[model samples]
Target: MTTYFHTAAALCLAAGMASAQSADVPDNLDKLSNFQSTGVTEFTFIEQDGRYAEGIKRTLERITLPDGFKIELYAVVPDARHMAVGPQGIVTFVGTRKDKVWAVTDRNKDRVADEVKDFAPSLTFSIPNGPCFSPDGFLYIAEQNRVLLFPAAEFFYESPDVAAFNLVAKGDLVPPEEESFNHTARVCKIGPDGKIYISLGQPFNVAPADKLDLYNEWGIGGMIRMNTDGTGREVYTYGIRNSVGHDFHPVTGELWFTDNQVDGMGDDIPPGELNRQTEMGQNFGHPWFGGGTVRTNEYKGEEVPVEVVHPVVDMVAHAADLGMSFYTGNMFPEKYKNAIFSAQHGSWNRTTPVGARVMVTYVDAEGNATSEPFAEGWIDENDEYLGRPVDVAQLRDGSILVSDDLAGALYRISYGE
Candidate 1:
């Protein structure tokens, strides 16, 4: 039977049950300023009744998977943006509005984060988005337009105060002279080859805007790679307006990314992209191209008759595909091996919301993509959003962790026969 529960009622039930298990909630603080004392925490998804509540509602009733699986709450974080799980089992996530990078530890070894601490503060920029670990084991954080690197020691340090963390290297990897655009550039990942890759968003809907034309001229739409020490910076591929979630294909060893297309365009004209990075300096067209050849008028002033890149698969326009990862663990069935699980954060500017559900990108042996919805019911028929899936990570026991920044909750999906 389908059950309908408001945000407040659901939280009341969850909080009451959680309080009996562990009363380790933080001392009603506005932020996670203390890292050491507030290291251990249990996340609860409670709805707000007053204005202080940020209108976030935890909508996911349960994380549905194949038969042999169960799910539960891991931890709750405020405004948890893009997260990166390090090699040492450190659960690090960025707080976009809270202006901090938090590292939660699974101290009890229960495969869940029990202690939460701050790794980096908003020391540099207004917002910090993408947080990933470099191949050499250093933590890289994207502070708005700039990228900063923190040593592994600083990342894993389980202190309650934010001042205990250390800073290794902090600077702008992409200088204004090389490329210029306030696209809120972010370092998304560092490949197995010891190279770091970053994603650059588009400054404007279309390219060649008179205001900031450098991104248009520099061909700054896809991912860029550089040495772990921030050397040998080169454009990995072009024509991606804004690729949020990216991971190296486990079988193909190719980098796969989810591209967010432009807004205000027709409903389905410019379908978003899921592309495989084959070579360096390749073009995946944006502004001038959409779902292959549906060109827009933005390229009318093309100096050299601009051509763009083609996406390997066009899932759906305005689906808002975000955090994605390949299931390399043995917890799921053999058919799920090497499958891609992605969260569509759902669309706001669109007439019909297309995302807000977790979908699986089924890929063939040759690395082609076919998508199907796996987790649903994140939105109500009344056009109200309940949860927004931001990112996904795997635990030691082979279960998956999904971050819902909308409700400040973390969910774990596990399977057993």
Candidate 2:
């Protein structure tokens, strides 16, 4: 075992020759990590060439993109939440709200996935919703209460039992008691500063005043950054209800993220937020301002003690903007250079459905940003959702991939295809 797998928190008892065996690892996982197949060799692989995939392709026909842009079904990934394209371009690691993480490989370089299977079936996972890659090719999965690390994940993922280690052991990412199912989908990105940034959504419509200090202490409603080895952990940004998507600016190195505002404020009160964090410890109003400049009903008459940074772009109310990424690809026109591509997961309880499509935001030289729809038609005439887009990721080939949990598929968007 290398020093990468070495952590003070993970004291293991038994494991295979190359597996990570730690006290944090369960007994069943011991067999999984050791490559000692616990009679669990059957993997639930998705069909890549069947009627189901064709149906998803037909759904793509309904999608309308800007001129010269077309979207095609890349893979059928169930409950696809957030995605991390490998630095090596060998495989893509996709996460979900449930217990599975899938490995998608397109070996023929055809831009369409050839195989889709569960990743690291040996180790159990809970809410493994975020998967990000280090520049040097390490994969980090932020779970509900733990952060697991897999080195060379792109190369090692071919096997069912790959080398796994703990970046943050069980019950350490967040306090076990505070863990909730909703608003718990974490998103992670390796920043330009070479640190891992992970978002932790506080589990409440509006965090009680009594819990503000505790949430601030644990970064429950904020984003936290740490080294790859899981040291030097500190709260980087503050005052967020639930930020499911975030990425670092390629030029400025500043952090940009999306926040879902307080619910039950009617359909059009406070808008969704796309915030920019120029410095650490900058607070974006949460319990105070629901989203944008609008204040929450709970903290209406209270004097806001913290200096709050309003959003750069106030999105539509209840559109539910989730994942985003800066477009540095060459496949698009000059207007798309440095533009941001994001997904609107659509509203759950809105009177009329608003968003279930991809959006593009452009930042001007003076730092002003504006957003507009990039792709649509996921919502049918009956106002039912055909697909709920979650995360946006750019492939090494310059095209981009959009993950949809409702359709359980990944769509690749390219220019002039």
Candidate 3:
């Protein structure tokens, strides 16, 4: 028997007994009472008042993929960023650059969502852009300046009030003075060692010299890890500009991540990065070597103080590579096994825009990597973006889920029908 813990809250909204007294639904717990309906049914395509549906259809027609692969709309989620599938494969929790974390579920096993709603509408979230799950069914959400843990979130997400606890309190993830509106998309992943790994993007194009030492010490401009209980905090990787996505290799357990390069450079120089870190305390050049040895304007003639580890693959300049996952499922062809699928969020700084597609990197057993476009045509011939892929996550059944913040939708890509 399934036990619904917050049945009263769910019933109040379902019975239409609750209403918002204010005209504007402020970002607070008060708005939870107004979410009587889940908004949209699963598997049903959302047209976003018709025009968005037309755009999706047109974009799908233009998209090119490998033979036997197909993509379809999964759900409509606003400002979706990173995603994590539940332990039972029953639900997919999505985070956002905005203030909400959505729970997407397919109750009937039709490979399409049945319900899409805010996970914890009663609680206000701040740039909760990353969601990850531990092997034990624990869901951890990494926000701009805090982290929250929801035990068994997959089961309890249907209700407005779910169990949640703070791992990192407000204003404690980083120093108060260092907080910035830019590059605050915190991403988390449970490492092979059972610790929580998170990327803290440096809040500047090129960090000034005065803040470099402090940034390194606090692990501000790089990745940091701590225990699941949120203690014993220390820096894991350093010297990164901003990394929105990362994953551990299934075999090697090495850390692989995508880093956005410094902007304002020419359209064709200082390419984006797909980096790998084999050991702790590794540095991937930031202000010193800007993408791949293309020196930054601030420290062009100065000497770099630390040894810099170059990226495994230098992608196209201003591609804005974001989330990535290693394919360990058996549903795809043999060539896709152990390959990395990453999302290029597209470039806004480039005159001739590029990216806004899915990229795949094949990693040989010897650690050599080669990359190519896997799914494309998100950018039209006029260079306008029809959809911007933010993150990619592999479903339990071996299909892949791609989130598009621009389109306010989630897409499912499956091979072999």
Candidate 4:
């Protein structure tokens, strides 16, 4: 055990501060010969102006993964966000800043995206939170307060540019009162039961009113479930301040989501949340209770009840957990099975820098999420972030693709036996 710890510590030390070390560190393992690194390694972590850059600003020349995997620059795009893979090796993703939805297809089977095209442009929204493929072979796009559905034909290998589908759902979600809510356009795919799960952002950082809504409905903040055709809408979970990305656990069929912590609650008090949707309408404390019961700065007088649901995992404060996905691919090893990968969009308010890379929630046999560093070095000690991983997607060959909205590029991580 001591030897294992020592080796792990040595590896961490060798990785070094993001800036002091060379980008192309030699791989010590030879047992896995199929792994290779991509992109440039010698670049400085800090920008030329000495200011931390947000999002993926610099092009990723290479990535370091396990010994058997190869990392490469998959595509050149702008602001790639959430992505959903299709049965025919189709990669569809939304561009948060570019305000478009793009598709990449591996038609030639060369393991690279040969054809890239924009499937949809920003029609009536600024930020597109998610682009998911439904079980019925339709593309579901979430624009703030609305859900747009598109047929699969518009994006098939040789299909037409525009899909035949129409806008199926819109922002008919009427939160009790209409007092200017700060909403995010986030909607997950319909579950096996055929209910569309959508997450709503809290009206403000904390519950703004002295009196909570729904009889001070315990655990009820901003999550709702509705029928696919936009009927039978009901609140699924409460106390969710913000949910940027979410998905069902592949094996357990459990729901998991990333919730950003309320700001101005101190530098480290309110860490972000990786929560399990264990029960319908379950509450993971937000304004009234959060950061493990650390009260929000805005509403300090509020009290948290004993029954408030605690977070399954607490990530670093201000890390900004955005998109998340489960790893079911056989590309890496058993250690990555069902692991949750989340993009930390980094922080701007905290004096000490936080977030900017990807984090893996290690899953136990019981499918609980435990926080761990799956990917790092995005932030250098000099306080610079080269790439901000926004979302993760699984390729046809079991490899993983990460989109960097700032750098406007896609990176691939492929592994072998």
Clashing pairs in 3: 42-113, 42-114
For model 3, state the Cα shift of residue 9 in Å: 28
Better of 2 and 3 by lDDT: 2
Residue 31, model 2: Cα distance from true site in angstroms: 6.4
Taking the tens digit of each residue's C-alpha lDDT, what string does model 3 give over 1-417? 112222335424432421332223343333333334433222212222245545565677777889999988787666678999997999999998866688888899888776676777657678899999999999999999988888778887866666677788778898989989999999999999999999999999988889998999989999999999999999999999999999999999999999999988789889999999999999998889789879999899998888999999999999999999999998889999999999999999898989999999999987779999999989987889999999999998999999998876788899997
The lDDT leader among the candidates is 2
Sort by TM-score, best first: 2, 3, 1, 4
- Candidate 4's error at 388, in angstroms? 1.0
Ten residues in sequence with the least summed lDDT for candidate 1: 43-52
lDDT of each: 0.62, 0.87, 0.84, 0.62
lDDT of 1 by residue, 272-325 (tens): 777787766677767666444556567644543444547777867877877788
TM-score, predicted candidate 1 vs. hidden true structure: 0.78
Badly placed stretches (over 4 Å) of model 1 are 1-58, 62-64, 95-98, 121-125, 153-156, 160-187, 209-213, 216-219, 300-307
Better of 3 and 4 by TM-score: 3
Q: Of the candidates numbered 3 and 4, which has the greater lDDT value?
A: 3
TM-score, candidate number 2: 0.92
Task: Give candidate 3's error at residue 117 in angstroms.
Answer: 0.6
TM-score of 3: 0.89
